[model samples]
Target: MKLFPYKPRRYQEEIVQTIFDCLKDRKHLIMEAPAGSGKTICALVACLSFVSENDKGIIYLTRTNSQQKQAIQELKRIAEKLDLKAVSIQGRTNTCLLIDAIPSLKEKNMSNEDVARLCAARKKRSLEAMRGKEEWNRCIFFENFLLIKNELKFDRVVAAEELVEYGRKYKICAYEMNKMLAKKADIIIAPYIYIFDEFLREKFSMLYS
Candidate 1:
């Protein structure tokens, strides 16, 4: 109905119904469908419908950036019919400019956890510098973020890449910007690792907690 953005395809109605039922009943669901069977939109519509009435939120996890981008495209379509805000986030390894900018950091081939630790250290320094600490070198990107964070306004559906570009243009930190966006979003699209990896999961959960 109103939640479904497109006319139902073959078996699409059944899939959506099953998903909505499972969600309402607080049970797990698994769906098997062929390529181009419209699974993404069906799942979004089902989840959106459930959460719209239940006053819950949706966290859509994907394994790759392409998958995350596709999910964001579908969310944009749904947002046309439904008033909602959606954001996609990538891990610090992907979104952090420092990793790309600094040849030393790039040469180190740091893991996501490594990048996160570096980010935390830099953020602390940035905050300290803001408060008149002169010895510690500030993260310029994070410093710019703190300066303009309150004035930033995101679109209804924001992709991680878009945020990255915006951060590059504004000279801010994209990873941190997405974290802020996640707090106000009705639907958050992120990598599956954010939930499957213990360290990332705890950090991701803190945004909601």
Candidate 2:
């Protein structure tokens, strides 16, 4: 059966077929695909296939916004073909609601006490401000996300480390959920983190879990 709505490139077809076979046999697939290959599409198709009968959906982990968008777009097209549904996740601030969308100016002027005060308002407003309707079929906003994030009110200082720490604490809440889904997902397309992180063997054994 054609796994996706769009025709697959030759390599994409091969990867999809292999992934399909592995999933059917209940075996793990660890591959290294070079750039310019349609790996994202291949993974999405397999995940869609699995989700048809299983409660689990696909998770894709991508480090960059552009890469994540590609997976999302590919999934949108394939979902139409297979009549499937999928969702992408990101941090609260990443969404349109500006859940944590702290502009530079306002943040600069704010004192410690002011920051504390605004954090709650920001989280609550960020949630209440957004539309409940599923306006964008390709992406879905996770409700209660801001509330959950604000509940902790992280106190980190540095920029990159702040995000890194956030990722560590809220392993569930993603900087962008695509990378999580991609690396650990049933059919994921992610970076080197999957293979390089040694602690994963002892900590998160299941790549997707």
Candidate 3:
């Protein structure tokens, strides 16, 4: 099967085949390739092939948003050639509508955890207010999120920027939308910290684990 858009050089083909073999044999692999060697696409196509055959999914971990976006772009190209779907998820600070809406949080030198805590507090207050009223006074985006959560499609590659746009256009929380989509995505691209950061890891354990 043709996995890449362009012709794979000899070394790239070798790496892809090796990855396929290792996955098929259920063996661990440690490969080292130089920069700009097409390692991203090679690994992507190889793992996608393995998942297609096994009826499983792929979780790709990177270190930054740029890396995640790069992978998503490559996945999008591959999707043009194959029927594949992928999603790129960043931390709450990057995708959270609540935090983004709060001007204080944007200007203050707050960590992601701190921003998350403040956002959670705001949400809690909004939920409490709902006990007396019929309408939601909390984050409108989050309330609207529940309405369209089930209708989201994961049948195609969605980059972080595109996901945020959908959320904004639909009046939902982008971060929450990503979490919902992650469950159904054929491939999930996230930061490496999601696996090691205690709080973040616990939050995504259900989807990733």
Ranking by TM-score: 1, 3, 2
**How does each model score on lDDT?**
0.87, 0.50, 0.80
Q: Please, what are the lDDT tens digits per residue for candidate 3 over residues 1-209?
A: 38777788868888889999999999999888788898889999999988988999898999877888889989988999888768898767777776567687678867877867866876776666656654343677776776667776654888878878877777778887777777778899988988888877887786555
Name the runs in model 1 displaced over 4 angstroms: none
Q: Worst ten-residue run, lDDT, model 3? A: 128-137
Give the C-alpha miss distance for residue 58 in model 2, angstroms.
1.9
For model 2, residues 1-209, the per-residue Cα lDDT tens digits are 36676666767777887988888788999989888776777877776776676766554667776775577577657645565434444423332222233365344655434543544454454455564532221111233343354454322111222344454444423443333333333343333343466753233345335
C-alpha lDDT of residue 91 in model 2 = 29
C-alpha RMSD between model 2 and the true structure:
12.4
Q: What global local distance difference test value does model 3 have?
A: 0.80
Itemize residue pairs with steric clashes in candidate 1: none
lDDT of 1 by residue, 135-196 (tens): 46458888898898999988899999998998888888998898888899999998888899
Root-mean-square deviation (CA) per prediction = 1.4, 12.4, 2.5
